[model samples]
Target chain A: MKLFQKMGAALPSAKKLVSGLLDESQPPVEEDQGGFGPPGGVLWTTPLDVLSDRPKAGLPTQSAINAPLPEPAPALPPDSPDRSEALERTGLLCTDIEATSEIGGFIGACLVDSGSGLVLAETGDGRIDMEAAAALNTQIVRAEHEVIEVLDLDDHIEDILITMGKQLHFIRPLEKSPGVFLYVALDKKQANLGMARMQVGRIESTLKM
Target chain B: MSTDIAATTEIAGFIGACLVDSESGLMLASEGGGKIDMEAAAALNTQVVKANLQAIETLGLNDGIEDVLITMGKQLHMIRPLEKAPGVFLYVALDKKQANLGMARMQVKKIEGGLSL
Candidate 1:
């Protein structure tokens, strides 16, 4: 239908077409009826209050909601010159992937502790001031965490994205590891989000820390 | 350089979509990154998304954005953070020659409207 309009062709009754589309597109909702009543057919089956708050579906068990995570990560060594090694040396995780194979001359990488809003470890650069990244990222993680709680579902967060003129920023939560995140900064000109996600997925498969 | 995401989605045809989550690096939900292994993608892309999210937040806008676009010689990247959704985002990429970024966001917005959570 949109194509017909583009081809210098006369559209066939745009009003009728749109009205038909609306009927198919608009799902019946309690919020839409006269004064917030249940959908057309819902009232006959269940109480209006019970039908309105229906969850999306397949909710996980309560035990899974607050399931105890594997022990919290170890404290970061304040002065360890080698950040990645320091994180690993804490004897908390078995982060054994060699940086060379994982990143391959990548510009920079870091693990920001989402809880404390601090940089736990960074690789490929000595002067990035990742601490700043941590502090800034903390507020974001906190805000979203609140929203997620409001939604009342505990499926761990996956990732966040920030796009710009010349850079592509990606935030991925270590869902298997809470309050710990993997931050990847990309040259907007160089990285492809599709390809980047694929490569990063491979790297994390073996990257425990 | 079309600003319409719906047209872009129709023309470029990305497999996945990307959204921002009021943050620089949060690649919320993307189209074609594949089920390559959610854990790895989440971990690595997390950094990329975070880096960008912070940069925007630090600018002192004191406000968030609807979406951001990156156009390369060969590709187009799309990011839309649900201003109301907060942490969730939508990420998308399309071929430059084929995409009309102008409509990509529109398509994404339509998708978001139907989103449950």
Candidate 2:
């Protein structure tokens, strides 16, 4: 049976009272030949009182009226970390390589560990064996270090530029991290060496450990 | 003395010079002498040239390398791949105190131009 029908069956007197309140045109209680009353002859002063005080016949009587309303869902903390920001921080290295590759006449680019010559990341066509290149460049950097010590010139390496008949190579060791460096190749005819060098400097500034 | 020797002798601070085949990393001809090892320098510089070529190829850029300059505390190293000779390059080292970059570059260009191979 429907809940409302069951409720009506349990509270016949209250149901009649509610109906009377809904229709004012109905005969007054005193004039009506059959006025509504409880089955045991109890009287109700008002319908609201019965609704508030009485429990339904078949429903459980476990302080339903005093049950606390469900608490509103808890809100997120104000200082919660942003997911995108974390991702951007983690992906910063790859983004640096991509930005470098976008320069005009870009051939290949790599981030290498200067001490070990291990390639951390590389972006280039397969034509250039980056592994061999990184290893070889490490030797060149070491040779430069040896020359510096032997000559006692006190100056440091800023960058190395190798211009060829067909290409240009730029190598710059990271200032912040002395053990890592960036290398890039470019086409001679298409790349502006000055602009390319400037772009590399900018990228170096943003590279994180 | 060969042409390579004669050419290198004219430079004021000419420490050493070598013509290296970039593909093989082998020294074709060499002249002069200094603390810098000509054979080792030529081989290492050839790798530099090859690496540059690989980088350009990987970048898919339709261009060429004109020359490369390395400045050190006491010396300057220059590498220039020949235009007529695709796989060969000239590697030259100069004493910074005695070498004039403008003059050295002009002399190297002239020597490269005069070379038969």
Candidate 3:
């Protein structure tokens, strides 16, 4: 008798799955209908009932909503140093120009942006107008480049030396830092050209971009 | 004159050389210019010479220029005015890697001594 009861319970769904319109007495699958509520019939059922029965994917559950908030974003790095100060330390270009002053017979030294003809940094006595020199020297550099272009000299300028009666003006375009140059004015009598060139090259190597 | 200028090629690391009349900014002779336009260089280098002279006068340095040296990443350029011939100058370009600046200077001086024009 129990086997007959089990077969009776399974017969309707088996017939419904086999033939879509075979069962007129049974209504469509629904939550309250109980037609495909559990066990074997649940396999052929729509996803609506399954999703409502359990939590939807990716949404917060009751426990997740009740749990403590995530430690307040890790507390903003206690005593974060001023950004400009850090930048200043990282960019040693200005301070590096200062080292040029130690060169023998140094009258003035300035770092110029070749593209804009602006003085990025300057140090030395007030004998030379650093701003003017920066702008004018930019022209000199451009002229040299033009000459190179016209001459088809497949090369770049390392440095230019203007040996005056009393002073020697040295201009070096930084190899690592393109579009920027170092200008150092030295007393011709006191400064050794070879040594000064070596020193400038060393400083250029040490420059942190 | 071109043959006289060609003597500069004997210098170590010699690239190109020319003799220019600074007043006219024209080349009297040129040799081994490679791809370089020696004519333009002659004219432009004259400007450099003139500028240095003007700078000396303005500063009241009362000193005559020995030479103007342009050191490049790949090449070295020396502009020396002829003592015997006023308004004429010698310009030479050399490979920086192989050039001995002192020796190159001496060679330029020697060549200048022999060059009469």
Judging by DockQ against the true structure, name the best candidate: 3
Candidate 1 overall lDDT versus native: 0.48
Q: Estimate each model's TM-score.
A: 0.42, 0.50, 0.66
* Candidate 2 TM-score to native: 0.50
RMSD of each: 26.2, 23.9, 21.9
Alpha-carbon error at A52 in model 3, in Å? 26
Most TM-score-accurate candidate = 3
- Docking quality of model 1: it rates as incorrect
Counting clashing residue pairs in each candidate, in order, gives: 63, 12, 0
lDDT digits (tens) for residues B1-117 of candidate 1? 112223223435563444434334433443443423323333333444454456565633244545545443344545455545646655565555766655665676666555534
Considering only chain B, report the TM-score of each candidate against the true chain B.
Answer: 0.62, 0.90, 0.93
Model 3 misses residue A29 by how many Å? 60
Worst 10 residues of 3 chain A by lDDT: A69-78
Per-residue lDDT over A1-209 for candidate 3, one digit per residue giving the tens place of the 0 to 100 score: 33233434444544453232223454333232244434323233333332353455677556544544322212223234332233343353233588998899999988888999998779988887788778777877777777777777768888888766578888888887758988888889999988998998887666544
- The second chain of candidate 1 has a TM-score of 0.62
Q: Candidate 3, which CAPRI tier?
A: acceptable
Best by lDDT: 3
- Measured over the true interface residues after superposition, the C-alpha RMSD of each candidate is 11.0, 5.1, 2.6
Measured with C-alpha atoms, the lDDT of residue B45 in candidate 2 is 73
What is the full ranking by DockQ, best candidate first? 3, 2, 1
